[model samples]
Target: MRRTSSISLTCLVLASATLGPALTAQSAAVTPDMVQTGSDIPAKWEEPHPGYDYEKREVMIPMRDGVKLHTVVIVPKGAKGLPILLERTPYNASGFSTDRPHMRDAVWSAQRDWADDGYIIVTQDIRGKYGSEGDYVMTRPPIGPLNPTKTDDTTDAWDTIDWLVKNIPESNGRVGMIGSSYDGWTVTMALLGPHPALKVAAPESPMIDGWMGDDWFHYGAFRQVNLDYFTEQSSQRAAGSQVPRPGSDDYQDFLDAVSAGHWAEANGFKQLPWWNRLSAHPAYDAFWQLQALDKLVVQKPASIPTVWLQGLWDQEDMYGAVHTWEALKAAGHASNNHLVMGPWYHSQVNRSAETLGPLKWKGDTAADFRRTILIPFFNTYLKDRKAAESLPAALIYNATENHWDKFADWPGVDEKHLTPMYLQSEFGLALNKPQAGEDSYLSDPAKPVPYLAPPVEADGGKRWQTWLVQDQRPVATRTDVLSYQTPVLDRAVSLEGAPFADLFVKTTGTDADFVVKIIDVYPPNDAEQPEMGGYQLPISLDIFRGRYRKSFPNPEAIPAGAVEEYRFRLPTVNYVFKPGHRIMVQIQSSLFPLYDRNPQTYVDNIFFAKPEDFRSATMTVEHNPQAASSVLLPIVSGK
Candidate 1:
C-alpha cells in the first residue's frame, strides 16, 4: 500500500518537485499516498514504506448529549500503539491532510509536526462546524467552579477526548494536545476535563477570555479591530468559502484607506451575523462568561503538563495568553506550567524575526522552538521518553536585547532592585520620587492618540500612512500623553514581573480612559541606517487601557469634572534598563482601535453600542505626595 510520500521521495521526483518546498520540518512533511476512494475506510491499510504507513478514516464520536461529532483519525502504519495527539479546531477536519498546499506554506502548523513524529494524530472540527453535527457556538460556554452555570467549550472537548481513547486503534492510550490560536483554546478546553490519557498540552496564542477584559473585549471596551475582522474571516470560513483573494490593487488601496481611521470610520466595520449575535449579549454577562476560558479553567482546571506560547507583540490574542498565564498561576497551577514568549506577532513566527528591536538573536528562534523545545517537551511527557530537563522551564525572548532568557518560572526569582522612579518633568523621569511637583494634561477622547505598536489592516492592506512606532514619537510628544520618566539609571535596573502605576487624577467629564505605557528608552545614537537610527529608542512601547478604574464588574460614570484616582498595571516584562537608559511611562486616555473607543458614558454594557452612543470626555492627571503617585517596579533582587 502507498501513503502520501514527499514529492522529493518519489521516483518521479523532478516532476512532482513543484509540490514540495524546503521547510524547516522537511522530514515531518505530510505527503499522502494510496488515496482511498470509499464511503468508509477499512481499519488497517498497508504502505510501501515499511517503517511508516498510516490509515486515514472518518469517524463519528458521540458527545455528552449523544451528539455524534465527526472526526478524522491518522494512525501510524507498522508501529505499535503510541500516545494520541489531539487537535480540535473550527477549521475543517478533511483539510488536515499533510500534503495540502496550504499546510506546506506554513499556513497549517500543528498537523505537520506531530504526524511526522510517528504519533497517532487526530484532528476534529468542533461540533456544529464543518463535518461535525451541532449548532456551532463561536466562543466556549462559561461555567466555572466559582460561577457554576456555565456550559462551555471545555465540556465539548471533554466529550471528544473521552470517546477518542476507547475507539482508536494502536492506542498506547497516552494523549497530548497541541494547537495555536483557536486550536490552542481547544487544547485548553480538553485539559479542563482531565482525561486519564492526557499527559501534556501546548496552547499557543489562545483566546482565553471573552468579556471586556481579554481578546473579545477590553477594559470595558470591545475589541473593534478583532471583532470586525475576525467575524468576517470566520464567517466566511464557516460557510466553506475562502477569504476573498486579494482583489485589485485599487480595491486594496480602498481597504487601506478605510482602515486608517477604523476607530472613527463607521463604514469600515464588518457586519457579519456572528458579530451581531455577539454584540447583543455584551458585558461580562453569562453569555460572555460561557465563552471565557480563564473563568472555565479556574472552575474546572486542567491537571496536565502545560506549555503556553505567547508573543509580546502579537496584534491579536496577547492579552488572552498573558492573562491566562497569570490566572493559572494565581490558581496555584504554576509549577506544572511553562511559558515561551517571543517578540513576534500573530503570523510573524512563520518567517521568524531574529531582530525585534536593536537586539539580534542567535538562531532561527521559531525553528529552535520547534526542534529543540516543543518536540522534546511532548516526547518526554507523552511518549515517556527520557530526556534532559535542562531547558529553562520558561523561555522568554527579550525585545530590547533580542536574546532568549531561561528561567524556572514566568517571573524569575526576585533580584530585589525595587526602586521608585518618579515621573519628573525636568529630568524626564527621576530615579527618586519627586519632592513636590505636578504634571497636567487634558485627555480628549475624540482626539485620542492612536495605538502605534503594530499596524494591521482588518480589511486587507497595511495602514502604512497611519502610526507605527515610527510615527508615534509625535503622539508621544503630545501634552495629552502625560510622560514621566526616571533619569538614566546609574546601574542596570532589572524588572522581572508585573509593575503597577498608581495615579492620582481629576476628570472634567463623566469618564476617561487612562492609558499607561512603559518604555525602555534606548541609548542615544547617531547612525544613518535604512531602518532609521537617529531615534535609538523612540518606541511607543507598552500600553494598557484604563476605563473601569475601580472595577471591571461595575463601571459608573464619573461625575463631570470630579477627581478620581486609579492604579494601572503595566504588562509583565523581564528586562534590564541599562545604565544611562531611562524607564518611562506615558499615560493617556485611549489606545484607539487597539481598544474600542470608550463611550465615556458610564453605561453598564457597551458592546452593542452605536456611534451615537460615544461621547467626548475630558481627562486630567494630578501629582501630589498625598496621592503618592508612583510606579512599583517588580525588580528582581539577587540575580
Candidate 2:
C-alpha cells in the first residue's frame, strides 16, 4: 500500500528509547524584539507534546557494533506489565501509525485489534534507510560466508529486543513480532536465533526464496512487470519512493522495450547495486541460494510459536509462508509451526478481504482473521503462558466452499485422491490418457499473450495487483493459447494439494517458456450472481522457463522438433469445482508482461538477446500412450 500516513512531525515527541529529553513545542515564534534585533539563538531547542493517550518516543537504539537503529516506541499511558509488540520494517518505522488524530486511529487496520488491547507497541527501521545509520544492502544475507559483519537482521533484532526489555520499564519483558512481505522477512530473521523475550511471531506473505516463486521470479523467468519496484526500493531508504508513471499501458511499455534488461536500463535502474547483482546472477547460484530463507531456517529452526500467514491469491510473495510451513514440518519442528491461508492478494489481510476481482466472499475475511486467528495466537504465547494446543496446525480458507477449515495437520496427497486429467484431441480434457493425438499452436514473440485484458494499467495500480483473480475468459479465445476442459460436471469436484503439470511438447524453436493455468468455468444461468455467470476463474497457474527445465543453475537449449517432457508443480489450492462448473486447462508459450517474454530462440541470456532472437515458434503438445500430457490433481472428497 502506498500509504496515506498523515502524522505531523511537529506534534510527535522525539527522545531515545531510554527516555531521552523530549522536544517541548514548535520553535518559539519570532517576537517583535527578536525581529528588531536578531537575538542570539537559544542554547537548546525543544519539540514536545503532552497529554496524549500514549507516550511516543523516537529513539536510536545502539547495536553491538555501536551503530544505532532508529526505533519508535509507543507506551500506552498507565500501561504496566504489558507485553511488547514489535514490528521492524524497512518501510519507515514512524510511518506505521503516522497522521493519527487519536489512539484509535492507530497503526494499520491489521494491528488495530492488538492496539485496542493494551501493549507497548514498538516499530523500528531495520539497519539502514531512514533515521537508522548504516549502508543498506537489499535482503542482506545472514552473518556467515555471505555476510561478514557482526550484524545481520538476526543480530539487529536480537540487539533491539535486548535493549527494549532492559530500557522500557512498562513492558513485562515479553515481546511478540508481526509484519508482512519484506518486514515479514525480518521476523523470519529474528526467529533464526530468537531472543528470550521474543515469545511469538506472525509473518504474513513473507519472501522465502526469491529465485523459486517469490516477487523476483517464477522458476527462472524474471518478473519484469514489477521492475519499478527495484528502482523505488533500492534507490532510496524512504519507502514509497516513486518514479515517473507512464500514461501508456504496461503491456505496450514492455512490448516496445522487448526485454527486461533493456526496460530497466531505459528506466534508470542501473544505478542500484541490487539490480546490478540480480542481473548478473540470473540463475539460482550461490547468491540466491545463500538468501533462501527456507533452506537457512531448517539448519537453525526456532521453537517459539510462529504462525505462517499466506494469501490464497497473493500476487507477490506467495511461495514463502506455505513453503516455510511445509519445510518446518518436514524438519520435525512442526509443533510450534502453524499455517493460515486466506482468500487474498498480496497483504490483503491487512485491509478489507470481502472480494477479489469477480469473486466475493460471504464475510469480511480480514477482520475475521485478525480477531479469531491472529489475536488468540499472540494472546496465548505472550500473555496466557500456556501451550497453544487449542489452535490447529493449519487453519485454511476453502475458497470454493467459502469458509474456514481447521485440521490437526496439513492436508496431504493420497494415491486414492490423485487423478490424472489428460489433454486429448479436439480440445478435450478427460480422466484417462488419450492415444495418439497432438495439438499445434503458433506462439509469436511480437504478439505475445497478455496476462490481463487490454488497457492494462501500470504494475503499481490495483488492476495489476489483483490480476491473479481476474477472469481467464479474455485470453481463452486466442489462437496462441490452447484450451482443454472437461464437459460441464453434473457433480462437484473438490481439489486439494499441489497440481503437477506434466506436458510432453515439441517446439520448432530451440527454447520456449510454457504458461499453464487451471481454471473453473462458471455456468451460464446463475441466479445468485448474474454478473459472475459464464466467468472463467483461474484456480491455479504458473510459468516454467524451458531452458531451466533440467537444471536451474545451468541453462541448455531444447532440441528442435523433439518431444521433451516439461514437468513442474503449480501452486496448491483447496478449491471445489461446483456441480454446474467445468474444469479447464490452458497452455501457452508466453504470459506477456507478468513474465518476461522468452526468446523462443536459444541464447546465452534472454535478457541480453538481440531483436533477431525473437522469432515465432510453433509448439505441438503430444498426448499419446508414448508421450502423455496431463495435469495431476489431488482430489479432496466431493460428489
Candidate 3:
C-alpha cells in the first residue's frame, strides 16, 4: 500500500511539473471561486510530528452545567506517578500545543521555572471565552447572591480538576493549580470548596477587589490607566478588538473626551454590559463588595496549602495576593496560606527578572523564586507530602537593599510601630510636626498634572510596568504639584508594610482627588551608577476620591474651603531609605490620564460629569500643629 501511494504521489508531482494538457487546459478555466471546491479533508488527521519529548492531547472537558470547556493536557513522555499542574485561563488553552512545543514557553510568562520540575501540565480556556463554550461575563462573580447562577468559576474549576484527576491516568491523583492575573483569580476560585485531589495553589498577582485597589478602581477613583483594558476585555468573546485610539497622546485624548462616560459612549462602549454597570455603580455598593475576593475568600475559607505571589511593582492586580493572604490569615487559614512579595512587575516571576528598571539585583530574582519558593512548595504538598517544608510565612524582597528576607509574620510589626513623617512648611518633610503652616496649589482640570512627563505613551505603551519607579524630577517644579522633601537620611530607615497617607487638606471646590506619592530621591553624586544619581524613585503611592471621605458606600460633597482629614493606605512597601538618600512626598489633585479628573464640583457620578463641572480648584495641605498633614511610615524594627 505504501509503494502504491508513493508511485501515485510521484506521478501527480511529475504531471504538475510537466504542465500536462489536463493541468494547462484546466488552469486557464479555473477561477478564484473554484480554488477549494470539494470536502476533501481526511476523515481522521494526525500530527506530522508530535514532538520528541512530550505528548499533548486537546480535550473539551465537561463542566457541571454541561458546557464543554476547551482544555489542553500535556504529559511528559515516559511519565508515571506524576501529579498534574493546572492553569485555567480565559486565554486560549492551545498555548500548550505538544507538536514541537517547549514546556517552558508558557504564554505571558516565558521560561516557566516550574515546568523544568515536571508535572502533567493542563491549560484550559474557561467557559464563555476563547475555545470554551457558554456565555462570557467579565470577572464573573462566584456563584452567590451576586452571581445567582448555576455555574461560576468555582463550579467550573472544581469540575475541571475532577475530570483531570480521573482521566489523566498519570497515577498520582494530586493536582496543583497556579496562574497569574485573571488566571491567578481562577486558581483562587478552585480553592473554594476545592476537590480532594487539589493539593496546592500559587495565585500570582490575583485580582481581589475591582473597586478597592485592583484592576478596575482604587478607592473611589477609576484607574484611567486601565481604560483601554476595560473595553478590550469584555467587548468580545475572543481576545481581539480594542477601543480605537482617538490620538497618539492618551493624556490629551482622555482630557479631550471631557468625561470617560461620554468618551465610552462615543466609542460604542455602551454595548458592553460592564460599562453600564460601572456607570450605574460608581460607589462601593453591594455590587463591588460582594465580588471582592478578600471578603469572599474569608467567607468561603479552605485549608489547601496556597502561596500568594505579589510583585511590589505589579502594575495590575496588585491588591489581590496580599489582601487575600491577610484575609485568609485573619479567618484562621494562616498555617496553609503563604505570601511571597518580589521586586518585579505583574507576573515577572514567570519570566527573567534580572533587573527592574534602573535597579539590578544580585542575581536572576525570578529564577531564584521559582527554584527556592515555587518548586519546593509544590514538592512539599503535591509530590512528597512527607518532605520537610522550607517555605516561610512571608518571603519578601527588599528592592532598596536588593535582598530577600523571611519574616515570621508579614509587617512582622504592628501599626504602633508606625512613625509619622510630617509634611512641613517650605516644602519640607520631617519627623517633627510643624507649629503652623499651609501650602496650597491651584489645580485646573483643563491642565491636570501629568502622571508621566511629556511625550507620554498612550495606555502605558512602554512605561506601564515600571512607571511607578520612573524619575519624578520632570513634574517636581510644577505649580499644580506640591513637592515636600525630607533631608538626606543620616541612617537607613526600612519600611516593612503599607504606608498610610494622612492629609489635612482643604479644597476651594466641593469635590477633589488627592494623589500622594512617597519617593526615594537619590543623591547627585553617585559614583557607581550615574543614571540612577538624583533619581526620584517612588516607593508607595495612591489616590483618594474626596467624596468618599466620610463613607465609601455613600459619598457627599466636601464643603468648599473647609478642612478635611483624608487618610488612605498606600501600596505596601518593603524598602530601605539609605543614608544620604532623601525621602520625599508629592501631593497633587490630579494624576491625570492615569485617573479621571475630579470635576472639583461634586456630581452624582464623575464618569458622567459635564464639561462645565470641571473647574479650577485651590487645594491646601496644612501641616499646622492643629492639623498636621503627615505620611505614616511602617518602620521595620531591627532592620
Model 3 has an lDDT value of 0.85
lDDT for 480 in candidate 2 is: 94
- Candidate ranking (TM-score, best to worst): 3, 2, 1
Q: Candidate 3, residues 390-501: lDDT per residue as tens digits?
A: 7888999988778998888886324677899998889889999887899999989999888777556877778877887788999888999888998888889899988899
List the lowest-lDDT window of 10 residues for candidate 3.
105-114
lDDT of each: 0.62, 0.85, 0.85
Q: Please give, for residues 104-191, the per-residue lDDT of candidate 1 as tens digits.
A: 2222454455556667778888877777777666654545443353345667677777787788758887788877777888888777
Model 3 reaches what TM-score against the true structure?
A: 0.92
> Which portions of model 1 show Cα errors greater than 4 Å?
1-55, 98-111, 142-152, 233-282, 285-291, 347-359, 390-393, 409-419, 452-456, 459-471, 526-547, 601-618
Better of 1 and 2 by lDDT: 2
Per-candidate Cα RMSD to the true structure, in Å, reads 13.1, 11.3, 7.2
Runs with alpha carbons beyond 4 Å of true place in candidate 3? 1-38, 96-98, 101-111, 385-389
Model 3 error, position 478 (Å): 0.5
Best by TM-score: 3
Residue range 479-504, candidate 2, lDDT tens digits: 99999999999888978777889899
